[model samples]
Target chain A: MVAHPTRDRRAERREATRAEILDAAWELARIHGLAGISLREVARRIGIQPPTLYWYFDSKNAIYDAMFAEANRQLLQLIAEQEWPTEPREMLRMAARVWVAFSTEDVARYQLMFQRSIPDFEPSPEAYAVALEILQTMRVDFAAAGISDPAHLDLWTAVVAGLAAQQTSNQPGGDRWLRLTDEAADMFADHVLGTTTQESQR
Target chain B: MVAHPTRDRRAERREATRAEILDAAWELARIHGLAGISLREVARRIGIQPPTLYWYFDSKNAIYDAMFAEANRQLLQLIAEQEWPTEPREMLRMAARVWVAFSTEDVARYQLMFQRSIPDFEPSPEAYAVALEILQTMRVDFAAAGISDPAHLDLWTAVVAGLAAQQTSNQPGGDRWLRLTDEAADMFADHVLGTTTQESQR
Candidate 1:
């Protein structure tokens, strides 16, 4: 594909506008609940007519899809940035900490990415693919620790995601739930790996 | 306090109307999301003027509070009705199965009771007290199994609730996530109670 200089500049500007729109939507979602986000408010915040949003997003769900994809991409980037521990148990604990922190820090993003709370908004296949990739990465990580069962994977997600849920719902901005990340991870490791926490630590 | 016959009848009638309103709200919530529930629609469904609803519920949030209390009360009844197994491990697994079934069967109630998805609707102290009772019951049951640690309780709730969340969000009306409930219970019991599935079974 040949990119004309004029077209490339236009594409860059379009991308920037799209990013700005997502930013506004997120701000509104944070203030109001995710279900409370209005395209009109998003446009107003950006100093544009509500109808102008259609040029960038077909509908509110489209904006949510983009946000969904963006959130997962951010997660993937965060995972990449981490220097993962070599030992499987320590690695799981590290992953759990990262997840709880990531989820509780910005609850609106957490709800969009994890809770499926938004009415009638299913993440597009493109966006959902990113989520699947994150799971695939988790699978590989678990397999490295000699834990590859599908049921085990489900249990692991529940334990970690549960911690995130508890933290976000029961005590936002508090470490009461997040502080259990290591114990939860170790419990999971012990169950799936058939080793005790002391053994894993050793 | 002595109860007058006329006042008792009036109280009974009011209680009946309140139940009807909650039923309508749940129906709407099932069709629409929890956040989508409207007092006007709920009133319309039960063939009452919008203002009449305010008589029963001071506000939309008040209706949500009643529903929250109702859901937890239902859970408590279900717990009481169950013929609990004598073995602590079996009892825990049984509790997990019961929770997954109850939660996944009604996504709206699950969101209201668990997800905290409703904007500006905090469960009243009266409603939240019921939830605390359920947790206390769980504490007693776990204690019977000699798994009395606070961290263990958090881990247990996370594991079971995770299964329910996965089933509801990923596979509503499917047992894909629910099927892992027993395994998850065992995994948790193993971690906290120091008992393997094989030993637990015996």
Candidate 2:
């Protein structure tokens, strides 16, 4: 049942070409948005005849699926690397800083994950699982930091998500926005760690 | 030097026509992303020839400007009517609820404010003034609630804007997202008002 050597080489080459096309499409979408892109345009960018694109991927959605999955995977990896703090307030602060820094540093990648319009598109189960894993990690981290109420984890995630979205849009008052978010993270942490009274008195 | 009566009447009608066109365009942009719309399509929806649209508004940008102004005006009016809470935490919670409800109810209008793409479009001075006034009111309210840091006001605005953007897009984890937002608001309020410690201990 071993594959022929020529067939294996051809498959590897095709896979490499598909990856190249997807990478180009991802860059184009970041600048022009998902709605304005087309298969012909993607092929042109990849220096291939438009019809040749079909040989590697079925449709634009498939390429998007690949790019989206890659972007989400990268983000989840970044989140996983954050150091969870021993203090509740510090823990939330670290998470907030990491989230904001990741979004601001990689604007195009961040938009693909959160901001684009793709109607009637469902993520592959693997992509969804990766996204969920990131969220779950944050929840476990919060609990370990002494956040007794499971509900607070959800709120923190939303706040963090919201902060990322605002920061990436180049919205007005950007610095102030981040500062406020840091303060919020601090507050949430203190509440979780039962240090609010001491912190408040200061 | 008085204008002719007919001239004045024509001018009044022109203003009314422009307003009507803007209203229609705003609704249309909501269903179709701003980039997906065209002046011709908007005119057709309003029962007019495409060229006739230019008689009142010069371009889609002009129409968008008008619609943006109107939406901001409505938001300001809504915020103005709400009584300010004396406690900082309460104030944030109240603001969060109002902001979320406004977005959830008039999603199209909300998206027009925060998510629309406007290349090289500087908001008109009048629009800027209106937006400034809205932020000023929030700042004053925050000050009154003893949350004197100007940065916190900006963060609250970003969080609210972020939440609105998420809700408008119909992102996954609907109920969970909302509940998380509510908790974030409460935690933010406690932090700002120096109440988190006292409340959590109780």
Candidate 3:
């Protein structure tokens, strides 16, 4: 079948409008934090009336859902492209650095995806699947280190997430917590996987 | 100077009014979240006009400051009353459990203190002093466990706080992260303190 030029043009316009609205939302969110996003302000920034904004997205929440999914997709893409270390300890260090950088590099994105900053906002199921994939990667990292229990996964998330939280909250642009990534990873490997590693070495 | 009965009564009333205002604020916070708290709604709940509410507290931010201090003071008291285990590994478990409970028991209080939830609200120095005391206690516990480096202190905080954040935000009323506190503490002991303990035992 021949491609329809007008339909393609219309589709391109629609996609561009969505990207425009999302870009405006990201800007507003960075300035005011994720919870500060206002659809009216977003529409105003886009030079569209609120009704026109609604035509593209049904509600402020729909835009948030899109943003969450997009951020997750971006994160998944980043993880896919990056090479994880084969060594268990180095792998955790790399993973920790990635988690901290991923969170600290984008404050609003971190808040939306990790923190309960937004009220009555649940990421769409598709978005959550992406998040699950991110978590699955962590489990794989833990298992590679021979720390594969569910408890270990939970502990690892807490350990790394805690570092990210401290960096973001207590000292943004500072390595107050980020500085500990490698040492923490070493401690994790030593304590959580040390006995196993030692026994295997024996 | 001798205390006058009427003056004493007036001071009592003032203290009671401050408590009343804070209580009202907490109720509103629980219902609408920390950011949802409004001076008008707080005043309305307490049967006072918004301006009249200012007699006890200067502003909504002032109320938040008081709540932050009060929560910190309460946590300090809780830490004081609780007995931490003397055994190095068990001590960490105690510390992690205490930290998790302190946070998960009151989500609003935890958010206010640990998270940069309110944009403009800064806790007064007096309250911050109380918060420092709590952190100081963690160092003491770390010392007791034979881990004294500042990096270990930073990592321990991350490990425990991450668990609390997961419990509060990701899975409240669940032990998903809480269950890992002991294991995490053991990891801390092994990696951060294990060698020291072994050396001391010799």
Sort every candidate by DockQ, greatest first.
Answer: 3, 1, 2
* Superposition error at A88 for model 3 (Å): 2.2
TM-score of each: 0.91, 0.84, 0.92
Ranking by TM-score: 3, 1, 2
What DockQ does each candidate score versus the true complex, computed on alpha carbons? 0.66, 0.45, 0.77
Candidate 1: tens digits of C-alpha lDDT, residues A79-139: 9899998788889899988888899889999999988888799998999999989988888
Q: A-chain TM-score in candidate 3?
A: 0.91
Cα lDDT tens digits, model 2, A1-202, are: 9756655877788889988898878777666655556788888988999999988877777777787788778878877676666765666788888887776665556655666466535667876677778777777776776665656664565567677766656563255456556776766566555564447536
Q: Candidate 1, clashing residue pairs?
A: none
Model 1, runs deviating above 4 Å: A1-3, A196-202, B1-7, B196-202
State how far residue A69 of model 3 sits from its true place (Å).
Answer: 0.5
Best-fitting candidate, measured by lDDT?
Answer: 1
- Docking class for model 3 is medium
Model 1 agreement with the true structure over B174-201: per-residue lDDT tens digits: 9888888888887777777676544655
- Candidate 3 lDDT, A89-111, residue by residue in tens: 77888888888889888889888
For residue B75, model 2's alpha carbon misses the true position, in angstroms, by 0.9
Which residue ranges in model 2 land beyond 4 Å of their true spot?
Answer: A1-7, A38-40, A82-89, A146-150, A171-176, A179-181, A196-202, B1-7, B86-89, B116-122, B170-183, B196-202
In order, the Cα lDDT scores of the candidates are 0.86, 0.69, 0.84
Ten contiguous residues with the weakest lDDT in model 1 chain B? B193-202
Q: What share of the true interface contacts does each candidate keep?
A: 0.63, 0.48, 0.79
Clashes of 1: 0
